[model samples]
Target chain A: MNEWLLIFFMAAVTYLPRYLPFALAGKIRLPQTLERALDYVPIAVLTAIIAQASMIRQGELDFSLTNYHALAALAAFLVAIIWRNLLLTIVVGLVCFTALRLLV
Target chain B: MRSPLFMMGRCFPETYLMNYRTRQFWLGALETLPLILAAFPFGIVFGALANSNGLTFAITAGMSSMVFAGASQFIAITLLANGTALPVIVLTVFIINLRQMLYSANLMHHVAHWPRFVRAVLAFWLTDETFATVSDRINRHPEEPGLRWFYLGSALFMYSFWLFSTILGYTLGSQIPGLSDWGLDVAMIVALVGIVTPALKLRADWACAAVAFISSLLTFDWPQQSGLLFSSILAICVGMLLSRSGKTNE
Candidate 1:
């Protein structure tokens, strides 16, 4: 449970994925299918993260109006579709969630 | 990618290359300005959460300095909060960063011939923002030389700003008794939504995201966040499968 040890493990794993391909570049190529699948990794991982963060409340699925996180996320998604801006989406999402928490 | 600049610099190669590198370095840093603006608040929020999640101030900021991966850092802190096992956190962070390999492989095709030191350093600094910036430059001017300098410029600038923002967050988190508990972590989710929503260009990408979201929610209570790992793999497979078929999942 050493924080330093955990950080070290995290740092090492984070670096390997990035450095391995550089070490093998030109010498070895990954399978074409894997190369294709890698394109979806970001999308899949980020979506999963977003889902769990906004939809779950205290170990249960909270799809009701009390789930301010989900509502704010919906607002952010709408802004993203229209503006396609990172800062704007985050600002709007945070503002919406904070406002909901205050008013409701 | 050799661009016309390389050919035109042939007359006085040394001076031309020097200026090209200097110019590209500045240009790379300049272009990354907007992205850092978007990502800056996330770093601050990360520091605050890490601090409140029983991490020491030093370790909270240290995590940002050493790991330097925002999404993974956020996940690690959340797992840390839940008292998830270290090995599981390591695996999740590794899987999240697996996308960096694609960035590496795609970029290495061009920088493979560069010096090992340069490539290694660039690998260390690789992030979603720098990767996007480098790709934009290459797509616009494939033959432009001095890409290494440009990459370094973008990476170094982002690193400085990211670290600074983390320090600020640590300070604020310390001053505010309940800031981290205020649902500030949602900022990371929305930041990613900003990134993911724009990039959902293909039918396969949409399929990947749709499956990931639904499955993750279904498996949210699974032990040690195994649900996250499972959902990501399942979604990636679905995406690749749909991409291969008649756009079946589209």
Candidate 2:
């Protein structure tokens, strides 16, 4: 029951942001400033996520080559730049990470 | 009481195969396939991690079904394992999911013709994968009709994949210790970067990415990942300010 309760809360909070904009936005125009901020969401949020996911290990900042996450992310970042293919980037990123983890 | 193919035919009797909606739906699903495949590993990670972290099977499955957000679900499992308070966990999840508001707001104009209640239904299903997959198509063809079906196809496809993987992970991950630590989460990061990098064509966008990367790194140790929230907001504001400046209008 407690777990279910938590799920309920999680669902509600998660849904509220997702639902409110759809419910509210169509009828009116938002400020230009807000829309500009919205445009930044993709780069801003995902980059932030990548930062921690790749660079932080065991609750510490990891910049060393042994941090395969950061190294593979760098490789993935380069692939994304040159080829600009998501599937290719992911394939290269995973292969690079796996190779580093095993070889290093 | 019939197979879905029959149901699909029943729903579109006249143009079962010739339907544009059906075409768009499948196309949307096809576009999302690669990302879905990448995320498959983490689905099991979540379930296996949840199981090891002492969550019951029902709770694990329930969170998948109800919350349906990926990163938040993982964080919730971690916080639950640490015996964090319910309110705090919920608050953190809410903060993390604030990004969804950006997604919905960005897509609002495309679906302006949709009824409010139906839009709410899409809101329920809107996720990073669905948003990322469908937004590209929507931006490319703003005037295209039947995109709602396309969006629905992507959402339903990703959602089912996620739930199934969670169950599989829970069932199989127990036999394979240290699965979560294997860094399968990198799949998500790589996939996300692939999406974001191509979108970073504008100068302000690059600025946003740089600020997000640096600030997030500096604040990574902050409690409950508050630094993520701070970094994202700060980066967005900076990007917006730069964009608003007349010189960087391009």
Q: Write the per-residue lDDT of candidate 2 for residues B164-202, one digit (tens) a residue.
A: 999999997789999887788888888888888888887
- Residue-level lDDT of model 2, residues A8-101, one tens digit each, is 9999999999988888766899887787688787789889988888899998998887888898899999999998888889999999999988
lDDT of 1 by residue, B15-75 (tens): 4646667867866786676667757877778877777777887887778888999878988
Error of 2 at B225 (Å): 2.2
Candidate 1 lDDT tens digits, A59-96: 79999999888999999999998987766788898899
DockQ metric for all predictions: 0.53, 0.76
Name the regions of candidate 2 deviating beyond 4 angstroms: B1-17, B246-250
- Provide the lDDT at A68 for model 2: 88
Model 1 bad stretches (over 4 Å): A1-7, B1-42, B49-57, B71-111, B128-150, B247-250
Candidate 1: CAPRI quality band: medium
Q: Judged by TM-score, which candidate is best?
A: 2
Candidate whose DockQ is highest: 2
TM match of model 2 to true structure: 0.91
